[model samples]
Target: MYRPKTTLEQWRILQAVVDHGGYAHAAEKLNKSQSSLNHAVAKLQSQLGVQLLEVRGRKAYLTEAGEVMLRRSRHLTQNVQDLESLAANIQQHWEPEITLAVDLAFPRSLLYPSLQQFLPECRGSRLKIIDTVITGTEEAITQGWADLVISHHVPKGHLGEVIAQVNFLLVCHPEHPLSQTSGPIDPNELSQHLQLVIADTSQSPDEKQGWLKSEARWTVSQFHTAVDLLLQGIGFCWLPEHVVQPHLADGLLKQLDLDGSSFRRLVSYLVKPRPDNIGPGSQLLYDLILSNRQVIRQDDNTATTGNNP
Candidate 1:
């Protein structure tokens, strides 16, 4: 067994020599004397009982054994750097990790922008983003699984700040039977056709919600699935305008002229009630959401008139 008493400084000097092409350049980069850099590498080679470097022309090249040691040294150095970063983050009172439960109804355009804004400030922190349906966000918070939640429903007695509003449009493929109707289609008329519905992703999966009067209904777990099915001319369903905007513009889907104005749902961002439970990372995220609330609430052009709430 080749037991070497090589310090990290010796390995660092060895790597620097290979990286910078020569001991002279490595000494310049590390702000050390060329003799010191040379001595460190020489000591490492002697301790390891191996010839680690061979100078060809002006530069030094690592021998095969030296290459193996260099690779392992990289992992060790990276782990040390990570530990330093974690220590610094802890000193700043930032959470090591934060969990955010967001509603599926929340548009990606809005969600991504918020995350982009949060990334720079919380570089050392980790984030877990959960996409949920109506009650999924609620369940995550109640179960202590989420530190922050962006949801349409606020649990009773918990104060929620309205962050944005998502407008829902009843849309279907152009060739569907509903598109052939002469005027505003009645709710009774809608009950006859197949309705595509996104299944609630909560523990209580049977809790029927939304305008689902249609006896013939197909259920799915994601809005993307429902959108895909709509594009395939499989069924008609009420979907978020933001998710379906490009399709509407491409003429793949058309809004049904319903009896009333468009249906709009207001969404809110809620921090877990106990202030002590939130850390610096979660607090920064919550502040960003509050600041960008109005920007996310703006209406999109895809909305048409509807009568139902």
Candidate 2:
């Protein structure tokens, strides 16, 4: 193998000299003799066959070539430092990556804030988020595909805690026939129109939820698609209140007045698939979600009691 006659220490010394403005200042900062810094830089320049620095009165500056080399060297040094951090994190048993499976019904207001809090504390760990619906969430837990899960269903033999309750409103386009009905509509009447439902994302047999057994039913993979269909006045379906709140406020969609309860409350749980081997990063995120849920609950209560303007 052909080995190059240079070292990272030599590049770092050159960087320090340029950064501190001179050999004397760099030596003072590095707690090294000025002569050693001079020798290292001289040797580095000789090995590379390039003049890296230009010294004017009382200070050192980079040459045209030195600027390019220094920029490249900075990236190299940073990558090395990151690699070291990753090694240390692995040694301490911190997961290299943690996967979180979240149901489509989970409120984005709470999920985004909890993720923002977890970012700074991840310590070189990566986050993988799986957006699942219904049985897909349970499949993630049973298939060992996730470290943490936020879903309505907790698979058998797994433990979970209720973190948030998502309020789902049955709505449709303002011009839809259902919206034209003045009184509480019967379930039989709802079965006459088209119903849009999200398809199960799991590999297992597809399970259906919230279907009114309408002859005209559309099964889509995502909530956004369903919303788009609703906007086109194609069908009506139950959607998360937070997701459709903007549409409702803009008068694009209207909630149906059902004979019974018009809204559905789905209680979501925070589940640990591998509770015995939970890592610190996952645990920290778990706690953050729980704490944020409490604050959200308080806000909801205040709004419900008409205490917030």
Candidate 3:
């Protein structure tokens, strides 16, 4: 089946090579002789039926197959380690735990599903989910308070790929005065009726200035709070489209059209170490988060343009 697995010796060897950059260096790292490393590599090659390295003038070069094995092996090793760490985190993850430095707000419903589908498979890594503001999130990244961070593609230093598009949606109460009115209204008028905004996220303040006029009924930092206030008929806010799909269709809320406002949320996945370049845990988390985003997108289309949402 071409199954890939890592061993204790393989683990040590991989670390040696990574640390020292070649078989001889690896031998030096493990305090073992170069002949011993050569023998071990030969054994590994035979077991995997592949050429792992090439000896060139007392140096070593990993073949393509060897590189693949190296990446996969490291990933598997990290996963095993993460499994152990998660066990100790279960109680804490359940106790308002699992620290995540996300944008001002994310989808609560989607997050539950993301956790439900992925966490159990992770051997129940206890989570301590905490939310820090945007600038604080960047600081958390620097300080190590956040084990993982999820934000947009900011101009400053970044860490991961742009997974999908996070669309901006202008939503309001179903019975609000806006829905009753005609075609797309001016940004100035729309801003006048109601306003709910996120103060700190990956977005530029100038980016949201137009969507949120000079006068805002409520200016909050979290999406949940904004949604709550919007549902209460306080004011409208420009939110990620997927987050407000259900509420809009349930007749609980409505999406407003800004004829002149340039509002859009380009979804991006910013994670340290990244997916392809990250450890197994981060990879799993990234995949799960993106998967949840796809599901959320599906739900959004079905509800927004369909007859019955």
Best by TM-score: 2
**Native-referenced Cα lDDT, model 3:** 0.62
lDDT of model 1, residue 95: 79
What is candidate 1's CA lDDT for residue 153?
Answer: 76
Instruction: Return whichever of 1 and 3 wins on TM-score.
Output: 1
- What overall lDDT, based on C-alpha atoms, would model 1 receive against the true structure? 0.79
Where model 2 places Cα greater than 4 Å from the true spot, the runs are: 1-5, 205-208, 295-309
**Stretches of candidate 3 above 4 Å error?**
1-98, 108-125, 132-136, 142-144, 199-210, 273-309
Over 1-309, each residue of candidate 2 has an lDDT whose tens digit, in order, gives 999689888988988998888999899999999999999999999999999998899788899999999999898888888889999999999889999989988877777878899899998799998899888888888887899999887778998887677789999999999999989988899999999988777877455556456888888988889889989998999889988889999998898978886788777889988888899889999888776663225554522211122
* Backbone clash count for every predicted candidate, in the order shown: 5, 0, 12
Question: On residues 1-104, what C-alpha lDDT tens digit does candidate 3 reach at each position?
Answer: 76654355865685576558788778877898888877777777777788877877766778888788777777777887776666655544422234556654
Count of backbone collisions within predicted model 1: 5
TM-score of each: 0.80, 0.91, 0.50
Error of 3 at 80 (Å): 20
| Per-residue alpha-carbon lDDT of candidate 1 for residues 185-300, written as tens digits (9 for 90 to 100) | 88888889999988777887545457878999998988889989988888889899888889999999998987764465555555564466778789888887766564341355
CA lDDT of each candidate? 0.79, 0.85, 0.62
Worst 10 residues of 1 by lDDT: 300-309
